[model samples]
Target: MRADRLVSLVLLLRQHGRLSATALSRELEVSTRTVLRDIEALSAAGVPVYAERGRHGGFALLPGFQSELTGLNHDEALALLVAGSRRGAQAFGLGSALASAMRKVVDALPESHRATAAGAVQRLLIDPETDLLARRTDTEEVPDTVVTEVRRAVFAGHKLRIHYAAADQAPKWRTVDPIGLVTVRGQGYLLATRSGSDRTYRLSRILAAKQLAEPAQRPDRVDLDRAWQERSTRFRTGGDQVTVLARVNPSRRGDLVGTALAVRAEEEADADGWLRMELTFQDSRHAEWALWQLATNAEVVAPQWLRTSLRDRAAALATCYGVSS
Candidate 1:
């Protein structure tokens, strides 16, 4: 609305005095012509706006003028409220601060925005305690000492040394330049660079950590989201991939696909009502493990070795149970 834009223009000038027409255009995301028109409108409305000339000069409001109208719009307020509802902030030790800020923001919003945003907040939930199956979910645990040291390096731009425990390996010390922290699905990760190469470590696998006094060698600015996305792509594509052709019960198809690294192809239900799926997993071990989870609900139809492996495992299990047909 022009009305809202006009109000925003006035507020922007009030907050940051002496802004050029071009600066106002950038701030308001409008063209300079629109800004000039807004300025004329404000002046005709008896606002105390005045223009100054020269290289460093721009528009400024009279010192004594002040406006009372201000508040976030419905979408903006709801976005902040929804973000605050997430549990990810707790890992960064901002739980109490986030709660406090959320209250203040809700209080400051216009009455309509407040009510609508509050209602929207209750309608959406992130990282709930239990999933659809009613099973409890728990986040990966990192020791306080490990979290604090890593957090310090990330915020202070310092190098960090940590005792990291990789899968099936003894803990080893490594020095890395701390970039930022990211949490997804309740698991925390430290995104960093080692010898100018990208590295990501699971926070729970950090046995110990120390913030080094030396400054970190990294770019002055970073887009953490882009960096995390790149790392995720690398992880998804770098593994020893094994594609599996399987037939699974229609109802349990989702369970089987969820364990795969990627689903290359899927077909409609066959005569028996079983769906045909072409799935890719990290490796043979991964493929074998994923299909095993569904038990009789899924069957491997290709990679003859996989069928034999499953048959042998079934035989061993039956023998161990001392069952005979």
Candidate 2:
């Protein structure tokens, strides 16, 4: 690991001369002291590197120094730079490896190509933290050790035992034959099977994971995309789905629609600036959460249980806040 870091240091110096110790450490994700030590190591290894004493000056290699690594063409380097800009590598527990690879890719390109690739990738953003509406997206955090174990089992075709905590349930250990891992919209899922029946587990819900030595019983090859789509279809069609008729404020209509699986019907805005609609949700709990998020902006007209539940919740809140019952 130190050897790789040393080589990366040299490549970095050759690519961008006169980088400050702080800058180098930031690029390498190391401490400033580590950068200083690396500089000493490089100098002792006969690298013609020198430091300049000034506010703007830093370390630089001897003139005409260039690495012997083959350079990437403009388009090739740009493609890698673009892909590295995405958060996909983090899903597979390869974030650091991807960062190192990205540095190598930049070092392998000619100066002209490097500039072009950097500009191209900067212009193309992917998987931003927030959307145009300013609503932040949820980021599911999975522990590194758990991800590593899951990846190991998936690649080695071994059975995995995971302590999974499903919604509204106690945590329990389950052994699964892992098919693969899938990431969508920042959330990760493990596609596996238990007793020959397909099961998809959210990676964030996994409290712990252990790779078993026993081989997994799965197909030699799988179409992961197709498998994910099939599972999604089953989930959408098979559930304790509930339909609700609601009159919602015009501005909150989009927020309500976003949570529903389907909008069966919608009416134009009434004189009171409210719109009537029929929406279906995955379950009653999901419906409650969605309408709850809207507060008084959306009113549930049908599904008497939902209305009563919301009313009771409001009453509790009022009592807690010392408002009249």
Candidate 3:
């Protein structure tokens, strides 16, 4: 513990030239005496750590002492700069600190690599995703903050109380035992347990949240990765792919073929001047949904069930819209 405190004290002095014993103790989570002892140990190890016992003094490193990181190689220096830049130089809470830290890393790099790194930034324009990374100048997102806190709670085995927002229902507050954080494409999701049932809450829909220091016993649910995989597969396998064969009015053949959904059509001038069309969909639901749009323009000839469903839906719609069904 003393060695750990000593290392932390050294780093603190390197980052900050002077720190009071109380400050160092609080930072290292140790007693004031332990902080003094760590300073003595650093001195014993030729760390140039000095202590001043007075109303205005505590611990200070000798002037011109170089940080251990100051001797980094060119690539290491550039990497440090890249890491520092991620904290954001124009964003709140980290702008000035990140800028200063990045400057130090760039300045420490070998003269050869420094120009190359600078030139790369100048030559490249990283057009930030306007929709994904969009942020207001001052207003912070509560959902985004909740997502971050939920992730930390999941890792630390803690519970979270959240106010959740749903489009079709009233906003409600609930406690969730955080299980895992999933990133789908670019959106974040939280899988949690509520009242002994597993559920997923989209991070963007969480209105507010706070992590509870106390942890509830997390359930031995199915492995999250496998569960998600199975869920996805089940959804994709829900229905069989079917082909819809339709007879289109010959006058509509060119218009039908012009559409992306029109798969294939055979043009044979029947007595009624109609052409036959075929389209494929992963499930009947898609075919039915599309058929509702093409009423009168297309007539379903195969898959009697789909045709019946479409006709029933159309009749219902017609009744609801005050048309003679």
Candidate 4:
């Protein structure tokens, strides 16, 4: 761990030119005294580290001293390049660090593989802005300050006070014990607890956030995957769950499954090649919303109310389009 810290200290100085012991301590999550001792150790090992004493003075390395720590193979360099292409780091407030690390990785690569690996990275794309249908996927915008504070609270094991606005609701302040942060499909969420009950808040919905000084009321260690899975199970089982029986065109099977919460059962295909299936949704509105997207490709078979709702909507749509039944 100390070795890693020393390497990081060198890299920090190399990147920023100069940084104070206080800044180093904060960045490294250590202490000022530790930073001083590490600086001395680096100098003793002929690292050319020097310190300046003044109001604006800090530690710096000799001019043009670059470390030769580039030991990445061709495949390793390409892998790092591909990983850097993802926008996940931006959601985690590590965009700048990822970019910096990518730059250093490329610079450290051997001359022969540098250009080739970079050129290969351009040929691959991850999470394109628009899909094949020309419809763009919306990305949630999160304030840097909000993400930073929430992240600090999660790592430091402190309670977080946030002003969050849920859908169609007024924003209000709430104190939550942050367990972890999760990002799905470019949208970030803070998985926390309030009054020992699970709560999930969208990061973009946070209007303001403050990291409280009091220690968070949570376990010392948490298994994020298990917690997330449990939350998902509760969510899937809890809401106003409704099951809809429908017959859908085979070509539109992917679309239906993607929008529905779960597929309850599948029946044999009809003479016309339409597949019958029972699908679960959150509520009537959810079932209506999803079926509406399928248009004529799917038909609701059971739960007469849902069929009537879809028919009414279709009738209204036809009326607006001036089509006579």
Q: Supply the global lDDT for candidate 3.
A: 0.65
Model 1 TM-score is 0.63
Write the residue-wise lDDT of candidate 1 on 254-288 in tens digits: 88878898889999999999999999888889888
- Total clashing pairs in model 2: 0
- Highest TM-score: give the candidate number: 2
Runs of candidate 4 with Cα error greater than 4 angstroms are 1-85, 323-325
Which has the better TM-score: candidate 1, or candidate 4?
A: 4
Lowest lDDT block of 10, candidate 2: 70-79
Q: What is the TM-score of each candidate against the true structure?
A: 0.63, 0.79, 0.42, 0.72
The parts of candidate 3 lying over 4 Å away from their true place are 1-109, 122-144, 219-227, 234-325
lDDT of 4 by residue, 168-287 (tens): 999999999999988777888899999999999989999999999999999998998899899888888887999999999999999999988899999989999999999999888999
- Residue-by-residue lDDT tens digits, candidate 2, 22-129: 999998889999999999998998888999988899999999876654443332343354354355556666665556667777877777899899789789767788
* Ordering by lDDT: 2, 4, 1, 3
Q: For candidate 3, write residues 9-95 as lDDT tens digits.
A: 665665566889898777765688887777777788888878777887878889877654433333233334434334222211222
| Regions of model 1 farther than 4 Å from truth | 1-85, 96-126, 316-325
Candidates 3 and 4 compared: the better one by lDDT is 4
Using lDDT as the measure, the top candidate is 2
**Candidate 1: worst-modelled 10 consecutive residues by lDDT:** 92-101
